[model samples]
Target: MTQSPAIPLPPPAERRRLREAQSLTQAQVAERVGVGRDTVRAWEAGRTTPRGRKAQTYASLLAAASATAHEVTLRQADPTAPLTPLTPAQAFDALYAFCAPALVRQAYLLTGRRELARESVERAFQLAWHRWPEVAVDPDPAGWVRATVYECALSPWHRFRARHRHPEAPPADPADRALLAVLLRLPPPYRRTLLLYDGVGLGLPETAAETEASTPATANRLLHAREAVAARLPDLADPALLSRRLAEVAAHERLRAARPPVVRAGSERRARNWTHAAIAFTVALIGATTFTLHTAPTQYNPPVAPGATVQGVPPRAAPGALSRAELDLRTKLQRAATNGPERLTPDAR
Candidate 1:
């Protein structure tokens, strides 16, 4: 007589928890764990268990999933919660919130002064906000803000002041001077792109969007900026060294704003109110239109094809066949119908 074969056990509850945390489907988890889809499902469903090396794989995958989940949860809790995974509108808001401080730091690094840098950055943020509808639609909101800030700093008015005025204050600190030397070595566009992309860790598409340029153009700007900076400050070319320097600067300056409060409860209430208002308004408008159409005289003109005779009159011209004068008149009438008398031009009257 032969003994029964040992049965494989299902993955433990911790494994299922890990997979759930990572947002991975059973198939995805199965693929990562090098198990069949059904096996993953079984493990997750507690139908069967993983054994030996398979169990080890499950444990490793679970650990990775847990780590990923933790990061996502932290990101969502960030006061700048709406920005982490950006929609176009959220990108606009993030740009507005962060642009000033980032630009101020960049300007300070370049000009070796805080006051002028802050002014430049503030003005840039104001201008960017004014153009947010257009600029926010761009792929790189941050890059746009950075470019705008640099432009403001280098505008004719600023240049005039720089050229004519004598330094009223003491010379910049030695470190600031060194940083300025490195920054000045970069051309305007390249410097802005590099600082916004590398320094700020914005992606290529984002940088392009912000700069209002093609991705290739942004890439070129970044490349040239890096090269220019590297040539001047060779020490920054080393990844570890650059990271260390940036860490030091970040620690000293603390440029990015603290996370703002998440507007959860109010947002939900406002959304509900708007939805109800919209539904009620729609119902009222429909009811009013129905009453009007019901009460009004109904003309029983038969539908006529263009160029066809109807009753005693020639058929009305097709939309495209109307003369320019007729089209203009129709457009004016349409504007009047939709927008009421206030929108009508004097000429329309």
Candidate 2:
């Protein structure tokens, strides 16, 4: 057998320059660039350089890291003290404060009515705040919150049950309202997938992880969501509305991204405990219903007891004469009949 020729590598100086420009340790650079530590070492030692897509990825990482490092340095040099880390409650409050405007914008885009959006965002944030710890730890906390807000915005439950639910038709903002209308019409899975991908800017893998779906499933959901949205666009009065709405949505995202970190308070802790109690109560109710359904005895009326006529008079058997097997068979037959004819075999006749 013949051995293949060895591949030539990049010079050591080039690799060192890239690393220095990014202001990253070899390991840090490797992680950000999605390369192994050994690959970094090889590049630095003039042993090898990544080729094709890998090389492009490395270049992108170098550029991004350089930009991020500059930003961090600038922030640190400011005279203001760094923001304190928030307690869970404080975090929830901060989240609420941030979500209020954000949700309104999202809702407005979705429903074309500021009032409806405002109500939806408020309710969503309140519920989210109660479960902040779980939501905050999510990979994309903002996206998770936004998804919840969307659900609240279009919830049929509230529309049906709440007397105070928005009764008047939502005022339409041509651009956003169109998108919202399209999104609302989509199936839940498709809607969620679209929001995660386009609205939240998550890639397929990230969306799959967040939704607990396979990559293909997430991709299909996104595709279907877009199709659904596109099919309804003609119904929108203004064709130019989508572009205007997108710009507004982008602005909103930037504003939220720029907010300062917040700290938590004692009262927030108590509220969280109350939220937990509510969740426990709901679970308990569901469990009780399930138990009742499982354990309750089924009632079946047996066919009228057969009577023997002796000299044109009806006669009854002695009282309490049914055998266990007879009682069981009778119940089985009743059940079989109630279920369907398919349950009865030819031999059952």
Candidate 3:
């Protein structure tokens, strides 16, 4: 006899969205799913996926959540409905609350640093809040934010940070520590691809789309990553088991995300600050340009010559016939030819 097909679970972000839409908390969902709260958190965050009977149970829960959310949405859409649509802030907050926790864990998996992971997710969300118009209209806002977080977390520039120059402490579990060490040894691209594909349970096409790589390239990276991991730990030969293990290594209990309200408030505050700074910079720039236009000389101007003493001029003699007159008379006497005294006297007159 042929077996029935398995139920397809929604993406991690969508799972969280459905649960949130129904106003269900992680603990509540865990109670219903017969799993620990942390396990539910891991599943929602994309750090891990449940398998076999548990997978079926989880899928069922998500399906019920989706149905409930749909009913609520339908009721709200009626013309005579009393419900109000979400405000921009409400939507932003909803997206943040739904995904930030999982993003933090995913980032921690990628970088193996709790602080950096938390910081990356916060910064990404703040940026999303800043560009709310674009993010709001996006087909997959969660994916947009996740991409931003990945970029920030995996940035090569982090190497230059003094604090990040040294490694943080390793995980408490020897297996987790060993797994993390091996994962870190893989090149960043391969590591990221592996996390998104194997760890996150994303299909090849979805993983490729998220990683911004071609299907062939993503597949190649995943294969190489698997080979590398298997070389060290042959027990994780199965892709499904590898994904689960990856999730555990990345989602340490120590990595806690900030409260949703805090993250939302911070994002709004950051956006306001950015707006204020841009305004200030623009005003300053205009003022600087205006000052330049007003104060700066318009045309070339040659410098004026300084005064100097006149050469070849005699000093003033006390008004004896005016000094120039006396000098002229002495010059005339020296030039006159020496004639008879009487003739000289008549001629001098």
Clashing pairs in 2: 90-264
- Listed per candidate, the RMSD to the true structure in angstroms reads 25.0, 21.0, 11.6
Model 3 segments more than 4 A misplaced: 1-81, 301-349
Provide the lowest-lDDT 10-residue window in model 3: 1-10
Which ranking of candidates, highest TM-score first? 3, 2, 1
Model 2 Cα lDDT, one tens digit per residue, 95-195: 45434554555555544445566666655666566567688776545556666777776666655655546444432455544565666677766766665
Assess each prediction's global lDDT (C-alpha) against the native.
Answer: 0.57, 0.56, 0.77
Worst 10 residues of 2 by lDDT: 1-10
TM-scores of all predicted structures: 0.38, 0.42, 0.65
Q: How do the residues 289-326 of candidate 3 rate in per-residue lDDT, one tens digit apiece? A: 99999999999898999987789886557754646777
TM-score attained by model 2: 0.42
Which candidate order results from sorting by lDDT in descending order? 3, 1, 2
* Candidate 1 lDDT by residue in tens digits, 64-123: 454455557668688576534444334434444434444566665545445666666665
Instruction: Quote the positional error of residue 168 for candidate 2 in Å.
Output: 4.4
Q: What TM-score number comes out for model 3?
A: 0.65
Clashing pairs in model 3?
none
